[model samples]
Target: MLLSIRPSLFAILLPLLLSRHLPTAASRPAPPSDTWRSSDRFMDAERGTHVAGLSDLKRYFSRFGYLPEPDPDANPTDAFDDRLETAVSLYQTRLGLRVTGKLDAATLAEITTPRCGVPDNATLAPSRAHSVGRFAFFPGEPRWARSGPIVLTYAVSPTATIHYLPRGTVEAVFDLAFARWAQAIPVQFTKTANYESADVKIGFYSGDHGDGEPFDGVLGVLAHAFSPESGRLHLDAAETWAVDFRRERSAVAVDLESVATHEIGHVLGLAHSAVKNSVMYPSLSPRTKKADLRADDVEGVQALYGSNPDFSFSSLIESDTTDSGSAAARRGGGVRSSCMGFLLVLVLVIVI
Candidate 1:
C-alpha cells in the first residue's frame, strides 16, 4: 500500500522529520586518521606505571597547560618524567579526582574527557578550597571600566560556518546567554547589525582562521573567548551544536547556550573558576546544557562590575545544576536519518 501525502503536507512535515531522525554521535562518520581520540591511549598510561615511547601524551597535556613540556635538551629516553607526575597530580586536584601523582584510571578518564577550548592555566586568581565563591579572575582583573551603567555592543559573524543550528537560533541562544549575565550586572549588551562596529564579536570557524588560536576539529576544544577589551568569542564550527535539548538531538551534542554563557564571561574579562559548578569552570562533557549562572560566577562578575541595583537574587536561580548538566550528556546513542527532505527545499529555493 502506498502512503500518499500532499506537497503542502510534505513541506510542513519535512523539518520535523529531519530533526527527529538527525545523525547521532555514533552514526556520524569516523574521524580521520590524524584526529586525536583521547580515550584510545589512557588504558596504557594508568597509575604509577612507567610506559616508554609516549612523548605524545606529554606533549598533548602540555599543549593544554596541563603539564609543562619537557626541556628541549632533556634526555629523550626518560618516560613519564617527574614534571608530568606533578602536573598530573595538579590536574587531578583541579578535576576533584584523587590526587594520584600518576595517571590512575580515574585521572585518565577525567583528563581524556572533552572540555572547553579555554586553557586550564588561563590567568585565574588563586582559589580557596571548598568556597562556592572561589571565582578566579584574569591577571590584573581586566574589566571594562565602569564609571556608570555600561552598554556593550556585540555582533555575530554572518559568515559563521555553523551548520548544526540555524544562524538565527545561534543568535537567539547567545542573546539569552548575554541576558543571563546582564541580569546580575550593571552592563547591558546590545546586538549590533555591523560586525566590525560591535565592541564584542562572536563567530564560529573550522580550522586556523588567522587569529593566532586555531580550532582543532570536534570534541577537543569546543570554544574560546578573549578576556575583556579584545571581545572575540569563537566556537568550533565542526561541533554538533545543539540549540534545544529535545529539538536537536545528538550523542555528542554541546549546548550552544552553555558555551555562549561561559565565553561571554571571558568577553566580560572573567577567568575560569575553581568551583566545578561555576559557569566559568573549564571543561564540559558532551550532550549537556549549563546556562545557569552560579553564585561563584555572580560574585566574580559583580566584584569586577558592581551588582545591578534592579537585579534581585532568588534561591530559585542560585541552585546549582552542574551534576544534572553532566548527567544529561552522553557520547553514544541511536541511528541517524538522511536529510533528503531538507535538500529538496534548498534546491527549490535555488531554482526560484
Candidate 2:
C-alpha cells in the first residue's frame, strides 16, 4: 500500500515541479536575429549609393521622426536622396555623434540600438531649436500641471501583466524606479490599487495593442510612454525582462528597473537627451543596467518640476559610485551562493 501511494504522489508532484521550473514562451530569449539589425548591410553605404535596401532604411528613418512620412500613393525607392542625407545629419547632431551626412559605421551602429519609442524630434519648432540644450522636451513642452505639492498615483495593469515576472516583483521594481525620480524632483509618487482611477497606468504589451505605437517584438523597441498627463507607459512583453542579472543570464535580457526609470522620465515631460550617460538617452544596451540619474537628467527634469529641497548632487554621485563598485565585486565573484543553495534544495526535493 505504501509503495503504491508513493508512486501516486510522485506522479502528482512531478507535473507541478516541472511547471514551476520550466520556461514559458514569454520568458524565453528573443530570436537570435532581429530585422532592424539587418541595417548592418548598409554600414558603409552613403548618399547617392542607391543600395537595394536603402528604401527599408528610409522607412526606419521615418519611424523615428528623422524623415517625413512617405506618401501613401508614392512608391519608395532604393535611392539615398538629399532628404535622407539631411535626416542622417540631423540624427547625428541630436545624438552628439560626428555630423557626417552619410550612413557611416557609427551612424548605422546607433541606428540599430534598442531605444525608447518616443520620437527624438517630436514637437520641434524653429524658434525653440537654437535655445534647446543637451536635454529636450516634447514639442509644446507638455508637463503635469499642479497647484501645490501633489502626490501622483500609479498602478500596474492587472489585465496586461507579464507572465514570467511575479506581479509583486513588477510592482516593487516600479516603486524603486519611481522613487529614484522623486528623490531629485519635488513630485511624490505612490502606488495605488485602483487601475482606472490612478494618475499613471503601466502595462506590458506585444504587437499592436492600440494607442498608435505598436511594439515591434524583442530588441527593436523596448518600450514607449506618452508625454505628460497621458500617464500611459507600455513595455514590450516579448523581451526577457530581468530583475536580477545574476539569475537571469540571457544575453538579451533587459533590466526592468532601468527601463522603468527611463520611461518615468518621459511621463514627467523629459524627452531624449543628447548626453549618452543620462537616463533620458534614447538607447540602452542588452545585459546592461543603468538606473541612476546623471546631472544632465536631474537638470532636465528639475527645469520642468522644481527640485526636492533635500536633494544633493554630491551625495548622489558618492552613493552611485559605491553601489557600482559593490555590484562589480559581486559580479566578479561568479554565481551567487543563494542561487547555488536553491539549486541544491531543488535537487534534494527531486531525489526525495
lDDT of 1 by residue, 280-335 (tens): 87877666666788887888888888899987767525476435544345323332
- Misplaced by over 4 Å in model 2 are 1-52, 122-133, 316-352
Best by TM-score: 2
Q: Candidate 1: misplaced stretches above 4 Å?
A: 1-54, 69-78, 122-124, 127-131, 316-318, 321-352
Shift in Å, residue 180, candidate 1? 0.5
The alpha-carbon root-mean-square deviation between model 1 and the true structure, to one decimal in Å, is: 15.8
- Kindly report which residue pairs in candidate 1 clash with one another: 47-103
Residue 326 of model 1, lDDT score:
47
Candidate 2, TM-score vs. the true structure? 0.75
How well is each residue in 30-72 modelled by candidate 2, as lDDT tens digits?
4323222344321221111112255666777888888889997
RMSD of each: 15.8, 16.6
